[model samples]
Target chain A: MDAIAEKKPVAFNRWLPYWAVFQADVRQTLRSWVYLFWVLLSVLATVGYLLYRFGSYHEGGIVQTASVHVSQLLRWIVLGSAAIVCVLTAGSITSERGTMADSVLSRGISRYQYFLGKWHARLATVLGTFLTLGIATLISALFLLHEDLSLDGSLVALAVVAALLTTVITFGVTVSAVANSTVLGIAVLWSMLCAAGFLMSFLPPRYPSPDRTLERLPYILQGNYDLAGLAQFAGWSLLASGVAALFGLGYFSRRDV
Target chain B: MAENSSSNMVVETFKLTKIYQNRQIALNDVTLRLEPGCVLGLLGSNGAGKTTLLRLIIGLHRPTAGWAKVFGKFMTPNAAELRRRIGYIPTNPQFPRGMTPITYLDYMARLFGLPKDVRKPRLASLIRAVDLLRVSGDSIAGFSNGMTARLAVAASLINEPDLLIWDEPTHGLDPEARRSMLELIKTLSREKTLIVSSHNLSDIDEVCNHAAVLSHGQLIYCGSLQDLKGRMRRNHFELDLEGEQKAITKSTTAIRALPEFKVVTLKHRRLELYLQEEVGGAAALANVLMTLNDNKVTLVSIRSVGQQTEQAFLDLVEKEESRGFARIYQAEAA
Candidate 1:
């Protein structure tokens, strides 16, 4: 078969949008029974807890203890299962690779664009899930804790912090892609998070009152509520989440398929 | 490259090489050029590096050396644009399970940013082209392997990619389905460059104008099918005669006679002959006919070789094996 002329590269263009990719990823994620189960169960649990602890209505007699406690518990829940998002992203790539999806690579797009497109779609999914849980937790806390728990400026700062912390989700996704197994990826993500938490505790100049840290958490959850810690949270979140996203971006950029 | 400026070559790999982490060489300094509006058959046995070569071309995996470009740009530059220009169909395509072609195709179409107006017509056309219109709305869980293959093919075309790469596109199809898929590939090649990998020689013998045979990650041969057929050094011919023994002894020793045939049973009738490379096959046939005429032997029939070209191909594979490559000739035996 030697009659053909030498080969040359074909010109390609990138006209697709990030939103479309994100929409496709989310649709696929929603179709998963596991994700549906998590969404339904998380919502139900939040609803049941609110109903059992306090009636459907919020009254002035509520205490800050339960609100703060619930906020902390929800954060833990969100972070704990966040590894699943990574697993999902990683699984998508691995399964395609296993079946030799390189067929897709013959397309015009470069590896960088493919990886970014996928990363963008996956990140959007993580953000969407985070929002859903946030709404549920917010509604539950508002009902159980009532107006007795004031929404302070500190609360606004905390909300920002939560959003920033959630950037950790990107790290999980990246780890999932490079690591061999979903379990190992999740472990890597968890270990990294635990390490971060431990490092945060060791930071010199601990807050004057250790117990007050619990009381201060809800303010931190409320994003921009506390101007005092605003810079710290923003600085840390940007640096940490940005670095995390880069890790994923870097891993994905170099990966085949 | 210049003559077809507007009709640009879609997929191109220049001296591409892929060395697996375990040190297995998947492709060795492959330099291939696929022009627009043509179909190329990657004919090889399993583990012949067909898939590996495909992966490198598509940028699914990094090459150990050299580079590949799709739609005229290196894979790392403007990747999204590159993706927009090519379609890929892998054998045994997997879905997220329970996903219907409609959803999946729609998702892919959207990913390509095909507007609602464009997506509707494009999706409908692709589904019809692949003959999956009836089940486009059905879940993949219930689809057969052939159906999935069709869907994968259809999805790859959603963007009307200029280059299409399909690995074993008809691997598990029924004969009818295989024919339809091959025909579809032929139709696609009218406007797009298509590369298909498969071990079905007969299937390829029909659709492929250009082909390359891979053995142990190295291309043993690459060219047009006609050129390959033309490269054979010998032409075969069979002769039937009465008093075969007398004719066999009388014929010149320059021509090799088959000793395998039973002369006693034929009494006087038997088959025998050969055509050397320098002797025009037709001239050799004339000589044999003359010899038969002189010996008063009646001619039964004369025809060109029935399947010597195929046998010659097997012989080439054996030759390659003897030179150091592991032979997968058992696939032909199957």
Candidate 2:
């Protein structure tokens, strides 16, 4: 303290890869009981639904009589697991502010890198879950329905689900970055989602056919796809998520940890 | 600005100020320079801006006015390269509850961009250094506070940083754990420049050679610990005498009459004499002994009791309070 000397910045290679944070977050998310429980519940519900559909088959063969819509099944599963995704990602940044931020941020990583890394990681988790559900739905359709599901159709449906999840996860991350506590982050995100869902339900139908907008909204329940509708879905999803992620980065870069 | 070229200076600040969103001024016009390889004890009461200053240096908060430079680089939001050279252990270090210490450290190493060849050996050595070898595989959720703190130390050292900052490192630990933590800090200080912020004066006294005292977001004093104590040392001496009441009373009266003695009080068989500032304690004691001898008093023992560092710190804070700065002295009392 007594002796003051000239200061010089220490030179070092600064490499802050988003992949590092992404990998760590993925491992932590997978190990969490909440995530594991969600996976188990989703599997059981899918299997049980398939069993019920199989049991309902009449004199006709399972291939022609049984009705097991893969898109509708995935929609229900995604809705069921929404809480888990929200709970896991809603506190990702806010919770770490006091706990691990001090150690991690004090190192050679920018706030943008940290936020992006986490966003990518959580998005990856949701996408991975959707992929697994897709495979299971396909298998159940092939065995129980005795119908060959088109790989291209399944991919399109999966893409729609992935796009929707990206928006949800990005919204959660934004709230987490801005909120002061984990509870607050979770509360804000869930409330916003609920309010949005409630408001969207009130809007009058603009198209002649109800199925037209349903295909474009990125809902997993709708299996029919028009190229225009899918393109609109992907564009809106990316735009919303990109905007939310940018907002999160903006707030996080300036806020004190 | 020209002096910023020297590599020996680890941290430098110029009029650094931080005002929270609520309008609370956490730090104000604080300008400090810290050299490398010195263990600096940051002494302050709670909310006295110790943590605020540390956060600014570590780039956790953007300064409201002025600026701080670490390793000669201004600490901005993008100063990631500058931060890589520093290791920081926060006041409360936390991790994902389910991860083990070894996994956590490995994660930290990867975040630091340590190559695989380097990370494995470094991770193993840090685990051994922090003495977490046996339970390194156990989850952090089950770790005691002390174990968590030890793990934090290991994680911060994963990159072998040149500057290490610990905020209340020994806080919330039992006596034994506190001692071990201090010993670890002491050992680390030998190799790396260290900054330790704590309310415990004795902890600082045990480990820090240099000290900076903060009061109400203002730095009141900053210098070597010995110099600070020396500056605050009082000119006083105590003597234990075995004598009759009459002799003691006579000696007190005689000692009081001496020109060198500023204040004299006698209680029981002990005597305390305050000498003039210019009068050295040794010379004043010599005069007191002569006065006692003349009264036929027997001197049992004599010694110089200068003010301890704790007292010096409190006195400095009190002086600052007198200058109209608010003081949070209850932390010191605790």
Candidate 3:
């Protein structure tokens, strides 16, 4: 037989690796009966809490302030989302090393591809889970409060919250990639976020006595809530997320093991 | 397209040297080449840079100096195209814990961009090829080491790469599984160039078309396996004779009178001697042997001394270690 020269087709774009990783991540995270159970149970608990609080206020013949209840519901949603995102991000990359899937690095899969695939999978998972849970919480809050939330002056507030969530997602991923184990990644990420919160609280009081500039931080003590203040918070979150992405991409690209 | 054997240098490393900060040199100025469709073995003991060289070839780590290329492409992870053309199997591969082989392979196949139509059949075929058909749907948690290795081999082939690099591929396998794995490797060699790094010489001897011995990050020997065997052959012959000691001594002395018999030992009725290759004095020694025969001496046996290649390997390693990398590289180049 005559020898034939051939180019084995490499049709998948570089992004294809990300898709592969995404599938693996989804299968790993969601296929576990425990996680599925957790998702359902957590959403139900949020709904029940919303109903109980509203029902209690109505029976007591007390008019619960709309602002207080709305803030409380948002707080619960943010806190719940934070915990889920942390759990999801903690295992994305570090756990892969524990599992030997890092062999993909040795097997002609670029570390960059491996990392991106993980990031995409993780981004999809955390964001997808967050959206699901966030919507469930929002719906429960809306039914109880009987208020229509609109995107008016709240645009900047929305941006700040989005940015904060992005920062958390990227920061958690960076930690996961660098950490030796999943538990260690989780510990480091949460510890750092907690430290950031504590440090922010200790910042010196604003120089302008009557108009305290330190009131601008999101979820901070002492502030006349406004979009401009939220804008500044959004700026910090964006900066943090961008810096995290750079670190994650750079380190994952060059790591040898 | 017609095959171009001249251009198919599947793996080429030129003056590759890697020195870690810990003062250990993993690879030292190692220049090598592998032709497409050739199965080459990188043989070495522990800490011998076998894994290091494979890592460089796969572009997992950058070379400290010189260059390495796989499938004729430069050694860089950015050469994603080249990675697609090459498959790597680590000594032990780690798959996602709960997923079955089929799910993992299917996912990888899709990532490699095999259409679902193409992926399903190909995945099924590979799973069966590795004798993992029975457990394709089962989680990898319970698989034996050999089964895991077989699954790894199958996964590496998902992209149908033209080059396959295996680092100690048969590391932990039962004898039967090891044999099957080796045979599978041989079968794969027909369609792709392969680089197998192993400390097991028997594995290299069984399947490798060419072999290189690595010790302390230096390539001490590189060539055909037959050439390696030939190099270690003894340059002497033993002759067994049943006779009086005096007659054997007389005959030995007569032979020693010639320049070819460098050393002679008389042990019982056996006389072993070192002889120069292509010696002209064999005829003279035959004449003396004839005289001993006439005097009623019985020539019991005559055979070449047996020297194992494994012994020569040990000697090579010792010699390389004593002189160290500096001398080993010089000798290798020479």
Candidate 1: tens digits of C-alpha lDDT, residues B25-79: 8887776666666678887778889988887776667788888877777765236
Error of 3 at A168 (Å): 1.3
Number of the candidate with higher DockQ, 1 or 3? 3
Across B38-141, the per-residue lDDT of candidate 3 in tens digits comes to 78888888998998888788777778889997766687755567777777887667776787999878876765656677678889999988888888889989
Angstrom error of the Cα, residue A59, model 3: value is: 4.3
Clashing pairs in 2: A8-B71, A9-B71
DockQ of 1: 0.36
Q: What is the lDDT of residue A20 in candidate 1?
A: 49
**Model 2 segments more than 4 A misplaced:** A1-17, A58-68, A146-149, A197-224, B1-8, B233-236, B242-246, B256-269, B274-287, B296-301, B304-307, B325-334
For A46-132, candidate 2 gives per-residue lDDT tens digits of: 888777766654344354322235655666665667777789889888878865788778877888888988888888887888788
TM-score of each: 0.79, 0.86, 0.79
Q: How well is candidate 2 docked (DockQ)?
A: 0.48
Q: Higher-TM-score candidate among 1 and 2?
A: 2
- Sort candidate 3 into its docking category: acceptable
The best candidate in terms of DockQ: 2
Compared with the true structure, all predictions reach lDDT values of 0.63, 0.79, 0.70
Q: Give me the candidate number with maximum TM-score.
A: 2
- Whichever of 1 and 3 has more lDDT, that candidate is 3
In model 1, the runs with Cα more than 4 Å from the true position are: A1-17, A55-66, A79-126, A145-147, A153-161, A206-215, A218-226, B1-11, B233-297, B302-309, B324-334
Enumerate the candidates' DockQ scores in order.
0.36, 0.48, 0.40
lDDT of 2 by residue, B244-278 (tens): 89989988988888888888999899998888867
